[model samples]
Target chain A: MLDVTKAKIIHDFAHDRPLLACRYDPKERFVVTSSEDYRLQKFSLPGGEKTILPEAHNSWVHALGLSPDGQILYSGGCDGKLVFWNIADAEVKPLRTLDAHQGWLRTLSVSPDGSLVATGGNDKTVKVWNTQTGELVKQWQGHAKNVYSVQFMPDGKRILSGDLGGAVQLRSLDADDIKGNFEAKPLHTYEGGQMVDFGGVRCLAVRPSSDQFAAGGLHKATNPLGAVHEPLALRFAFEGNQLLKSHVSEGITGGGLWRVQWLSDGTLMGVSGGSSGGFLIFWNDQQDKDFSKFKLPALARDMDLSTNGLNVVTAHHDGHVRITRLSES
Target chain B: MKCPYACGSTEHLMARRKFLSLSASGAVGVAGGLGLLTRGAAAEQVQQKQQRIVVFNMHGGLSQLESWDPKPGTRTGGPFRAIPTSVPGLHISELLPYTAQQMHHLCLFRGVNTSEDDHGKGAYMMMTGRRQTPAADYPEIGAVAAKTLMPEDSSLPGHIRVVPHGGGGRGSDAAYLGPKYSSIHLGNGNPPQYTKRPDGITDEAERRRQEFRRKSDRRFLDGRRTAMTDVFTYSFEQADRLMEQRDVFDVTKEPTQDQEKYGTHDFGRHCLLARRLIERGISFVQVSHSNYDTHNENFDFHLEQVGEFDRPFATFVADLAERGLLDQTLIVVLSEFGRTPNINLYLGRDHWSKAWSVLAGGAKLARGAVLGATNAEGTEVVDIQVDHAQLFHTYLQAVGVDTSASFQIDGRELPIADPSAEPIWTAIA
Candidate 1:
């Protein structure tokens, strides 16, 4: 089991601005990050050497995906363009670029076998593309609002997407119709006083050892524009899209967790930000509250767990890409 | 590209020619445009008889990056996309698609740098067209319009403000403009509070009471009459007349189809009421849609708040145009200031007064014109930059009011708009 009490920060790589997304190289060579400055950068694992890539996006890049074989990387940006990069290229430049959406592209997920990539956008669309050719395999526009999160299921035959209205729709690769929809209503709010709908499914994680998944967001938005709310995560059964448990905690006051991941030991981890500062909270399926937690240096926008499950990397607004060792020093 | 629809109409061309001809002549000079109001009474009469203005105050700081001056594909543009409008190449954020369809009737004045980031100060500058100074207090445009456009025989109060969520009261924003032109707040689509007569008093009883009060007022003021007393009497009579026609403020009486078209939200109802007042011949109507401060979750709130704002605003404009009020009415969409171009750590934008946009339309103003430009990243205005004073002059000038002229008040000649800034000439018809 992952021991939250033993986790300690081993490295804090400072950058110029807030980082939005972070991912570990499959070969354990480096860690990649996209940030508020619209730059994609890589930090070497041991030495913490930094390499800033050439300009590939004119806007903030929010989603990054590495192929299973670890040779290719795909980045989706608020500019709605998706760019492909060869990881081993001495001169790091875009290999191919596609104008993938009508508006901001928010999230992208590489399929289990790395044959396809699924992406979501502010255009209320979920699109699947052939990874090798960068050809759009199929595109669907069914969300009532902006699509904030999307993920390819472990089976590779299905995909799930979440929207601004807190709707999680399940779909099949072979069909155009929706297989099912799980309404994560607690993760959404239509604040009448402000006449605004705030909060959405911000992040999603699939349990590695079980047929279950979790969606992370915020609720109780008494004042959404003011950033008043609490963090909420819902665990669901993958078989019928049944909601099984709701994980919540106290003393948030404001802000929410936007990134989540499943740990090797079946613990669920989420990185939160906003007025509540930054925190990493862990939960188990049997409990309705977090089992353990650790505070972050500042607000964390995104987080990732390495394949080896020993290092936890968090992207923070303090301009630090922090690496936390999960085991004893 | 210049909009084809606004300029192509045969009647519009004739009007445009007449407008242009007048704009060049000494007989139709605006105060700020031609340096002085030398046209005498002909222009003053036209200004009094023809002009109307509706102001939409997007309370709190609205995000220019998400509304008028979208920099989609840029780092600071957030996650919204900019979409094309009816005005050919002019585009706004997708959050305002409904408003985009009405863009042909409006001009995007994209280069506004008011330079006042504080809420109270910025609001004062935008509304009165002057910097806030301890030495001077200026009336907002609404009060100015109400006083300037008052018909000789009309008892109806010309200034009205519609807010759907607050308690109604008479506003004191008139400043030096006097209480006679102050705004009567219409709260929550309900008519001015206490417009209805008490059950205990019949019409005859009310008439008798009013007659007695007027007689007492005349007798008491006969020896000690003052300017303040006259102002009070005039305001009371206006209020009495409004009570008789109070049903006009009840928006539920509007057609169900009309109500549905504007949406059922608070902002929507307020917009409907604004249109109703405009159609009722009120010279100045201000409707506010608010809570756009957006210190966090900027995208989500804008997606919702701007969405709520879009349909109602468009419907108000289209309905006025359909009713032939567009020719005489000036519509202004304004805010205290705009949110920053920088996307902060909370995914929110801070106060940015350096560069932004304001939407102006109708009256005799130029249609389908883009008055200014912001660079690709929207960090600054790259062309035709104008400030609040210039905008104030432009709005007054659009209604044929000479911004250079002074209002003769209490033996003092107070200049109407700021003398330091002139109207935006390119925005005029």
Candidate 2:
């Protein structure tokens, strides 16, 4: 039997604004949380003391991305600049800041090889920057709406970017013209909007080794039966080509499904809200259709599956980190 | 090799002249000739053809009873009257006076039946002319037309779909053709976005940049002339030229009279653009019109929609005929399915896939006629049954495509059109 069980929160720390997103380092030694309170916190593993980076950003840090090598951290806020942090250095100062985006940056995705970082913003553009040189190498300029999330393929050959229009556009980075203003032509586009019946893609995450990925967000629909249809959905895409399946969760009344992440082991994780209140759910693909959902205890603002696959963590709206393990039979 | 069916008709003969003119107008590079020569082989099946297909996808389910199959003076017939069209005895909804006036130029299929009521699945069935698959999705008709009919040498896109898939959260999409054949969506219909060049890039500067890129691409290709050799090379060259003429999407440069005739509505303007694209030798263009889902106030809603649709559709058909392009341009008006014959208490129509309607005009469709008919209540097809498969077969046949043709997929020999379907000869020229 396969099951997921969330443990009790070890430490509780509250923030004025909700914790919008969270991430873990490759080694699982540290956890990072970005909040709408305009602050980022770096916490030691297994619920130790946390160090808040109060001077990190000016506005709400809506997005956070870690380089594949775990050497650098990229964060974007409502202020529209992508700040890169050198993870190895004791002094946490932004190594570089990209201010070319016209609107608030919504997502940041680092290539698996740690060579490229793709940033999508509310300006309806996705721009790729060379991690080492900070040069804008490619720009995807076609989406008519704000972009929400971006994920690079495991092999670093291609990348996927999602927009507010519910499109998952796969863009290829030209190898020959590394700095020659490579145009991002979409290789695949998913109607993430249709799958969830939602407004658009709120978040997306690619699996570690496979082309399979997950997209999660809120959905809204007008039912002919006089009932409105609303739900949170995890749409799975295989080979970055098409959406294979969709798992619907309870809908949020006011807030929506804000974050979605996949572990190296291919388990999906995300936050959802309902009448019973907000909860974190771990999706085990191996679960039978009848028994698929496992809700966490607290109101998780965001959640992440560890790269090591041994632990799962949740960033609570109450400002606490809940670390838990999966109990498999 | 010449197409065996080529009788040097006005269409085929005129197409040849236009093709020659287009090739000559862009004769700056020797590469252009090579692209055209290679394009010759890929398009051998289509001959030296320049046919266009404009698909007006009426998103949401349009009711056959309310629009095309009116049961006038019957209980099922809502509060609406049938108006006589320009073609004697042919009548359509009073709501569509404009379309009625131009009815001589249109053809209606009123007996279409399907099993899928879900918007997503129905859309897939309509676009691909096949049932939805659990494993492998199929390419849409536009994608297939782009593959089979579009000239590989054309500088414009072979298939252009201006609306986002399925018209905003309706689950409409290009299923299996992969992203390569996906549409360059013109974003929302609110105000066409993504149609402008970046600021600070002067025309001279832009041309210089393109020239530089071309030089760089040429030098790069010359260095690996032996390594990278295949149909991809030809595709890339065509894509390069398409990038140059990207401004073809702009409607601002069109004549004031023409733009005004197309109207200021998004759908109307998009229809004009679709015609413009087809004129430029594009094989397929889909213009999506939205908000046809009339779950409430059915009669009132359809009245408004048909009102908006009437003038533009008539104007488009007239414009096509005026340009002498109607004979070679197939205009298809399609939707997912029809609404319920019985109006609900909310004065609404629910989803019904049993019987509906689709309109075909231009190309070889018999003009000034309505094919097939529904029962008295407009609830089911009682005369000349035209299922979705047969409708698709008739459409392909009217466009000069062989409906009986077959293709191999996963080791199985599959007919392109449904095997059980027979093309409706009455609807085809």
Candidate 3:
């Protein structure tokens, strides 16, 4: 159902500063992005009209999510604040802002029903909040390091959070923390030479209509201080929480895989950034190596797919949000 | 000869060769009474200037935005937040929670513009307080302090560098002041080999052998007491004294709580050893905590590095203050330069010398003081800009050395510091 080999850049919305992530409105009318410039950017679809959203967070905002109806956009920032905006408004502003975490709120995942939002960050905690009232509903702790990636299971009954040390834990919505653990040790590297702990779980994705999920990160850090590392991904079976396969690059010198997603046909797509620049890699379920790959003009920090399964948006370090058409019209 | 309880590592072998060489006599023998004429006249009376100096050399370019002068909430501020310190109105990066409580004993010079970006040249400027010119070379601060403050009766080497890597050896940074004042590199804070008699050699036998050697040397030198023989004798006598004080190198001798206060990691152990050496009256101790050149993932690396550096460094400062040593010691924390405020593509900060900060305390420095100021974005100094020359003068003057005085060397009088620059008077009590 997906043909990544035929992908081509459809448009580029320049922001003039490094961007971290982008998300398309399910309605396909506009797209919003978060960047290191400490603000959010909106670009109207087809017309490519660029608009600067009202400054909601005091620091670089990196995480974004949208309601199922695409009316409410939730953004999280390094300032530890989470804010909501009415995406349908002509002049959108922060409808409500909540102090979500202690510091550097890094990742957020919205429930399939669009009622709850889960967040994780440098504070080493996972939090869930009510989207309507902006009230914190639950707080999960046990991570020894920064929490970098978070996601809600499609069933809406559980959530998964990953940390800088590459530990992935699955938690349930009804009871206490930590339902199960998945092995992802290949992504952790404690560099003794510089006394730096390198690598982290960067992104997570679950296959539609299946019982498997994947986490992307870095492995075999050669020179961590210089960011010399290789990209890696692990797919796990939901039955025993056992690892199924470890996806790796051919020979790309990189920092790590920043974001990953499962296609309609269960094909895995990953975006890599680092010394060799950025690349889009496509992989099959049964193999550890990529089946095909595409090169990007610059390193990408985050990636999001359009609802139609034909288009994808990537946040680039070269100060542009590029929309790539993954299939020929 | 080996340390009586030696581990027999090849490092000890290299150390023995370096420390026992004739050139190293000047490095180990600050108490060589015959060498006093080559010292700085301004500080000739070491008894009156029993002052000490300690430097925490943060190697590589430490990002000012993530440490001393945080510009949080600004475009160039990066991710980490700035938290309040012990001193009222003083704030530093949140990465240094342990160090925040010890800020009362510290002062910051925020508007430093050394203008050198290369690592080697910037390090030379910071440690030696002068630009690297082709015509002239200068000694590091450790060498200067050793020659100026080491008492004639002191038994230990005056200048010591506790490095976490490499083997024990002597540095060659004394420049025109001669090799005798060079800093001794104590790898992992351990002294060189031969610090103890072998298992079979009794003390009485050792004393008798030493006496016999002295007698033989006296007879041979009756007509040939030359510079070479004098240097050799000085080296031998000092080596014996160091062996007697080898117990100071064993950090495990400290209280369990004290060792635990500083983490048991390599940097912590090295810092503890530096403390012992200073408490034992060493004139200058340099502790290196390195590899801060974060060209990628600067925030993550700082979180690890600055977090590791926070507790032990603060504990050391607090201990010095409680022991009354703060009144006589000049302590400083510095690096080659500061990182750029502009975040790069990889979220890394590049080498930036336009505006940075340095931390200093102890001796005559005003406690809880902040000197100079950076603009809101930290791109430039808005007030009280000072360079390395001024910083060098501040260091020596804080320890009671007269900045206007000169050191007499081979019939030539060299000014102790750059004559064109002066210390930030406001920072001095």
Q: Estimate each model's TM-score.
A: 0.80, 0.49, 0.89
**Model 2 clash pairs?**
A13-A319, A198-A219, B166-B172
C-alpha-based local distance difference test score of model 3:
0.84
What docking grade does candidate 2 earn?
A: incorrect
* Model 2, position A251: C-alpha lDDT score: 33
The two-chain DockQ for each candidate, comma-separated, is: 0.35, 0.01, 0.59
RMSD of 2: 22.3
What i-RMS does every model get? 2.9, 20.3, 1.8
lDDT of 3 by residue, B1-429 (tens): 211211233433333344335233546442455345355567753447479999999888888999999998788888778899999999999888888998899889999999999999999999888899999888899988887887766777888888877588788887766566788788876775567778899999889987897678668756654434554666677677877888877788988889998889878987888888888888999999977889888887887788889999998999999999898888999999999998887888889898999999998899999999999999999999999999999998888888778876645678888889998888899
Clashing pairs in model 3, backbone N/Cα/C closer than 3 A: B26-B180
| lDDT, model 2, position B294 | 70
Off by over 4 Å in 2: A1-329, B1-49, B164-180, B188-196, B201-243, B406-415
Off by over 4 Å in 3: A132-137, A174-177, A238-244, B1-30, B34-37, B45-49, B86-89, B134-136, B189-236
Question: Mind giving the per-residue lDDT tens digits that candidate 2 earns over A68-160?
Answer: 766788888756778888753455567887784764687888887888888898788888898888899988776766777777777787777
Taking all chains together, the TM-score of candidate 3 against the true structure is: 0.89
TM-score: which is higher, 2 or 3?
A: 3
Q: Residue B414, candidate 2: how far off, in angstroms?
A: 6.2
Decide which is better by TM-score, 1 or 2: 1
Q: What is residue B183's positional error in candidate 3, in angstroms?
A: 2.6
Q: Which structure among the candidates has the greatest DockQ?
A: 3
- Write down the lDDT of every candidate, Cα atoms only: 0.81, 0.64, 0.84
Order of the predicted models by TM-score, top scorer first? 3, 1, 2
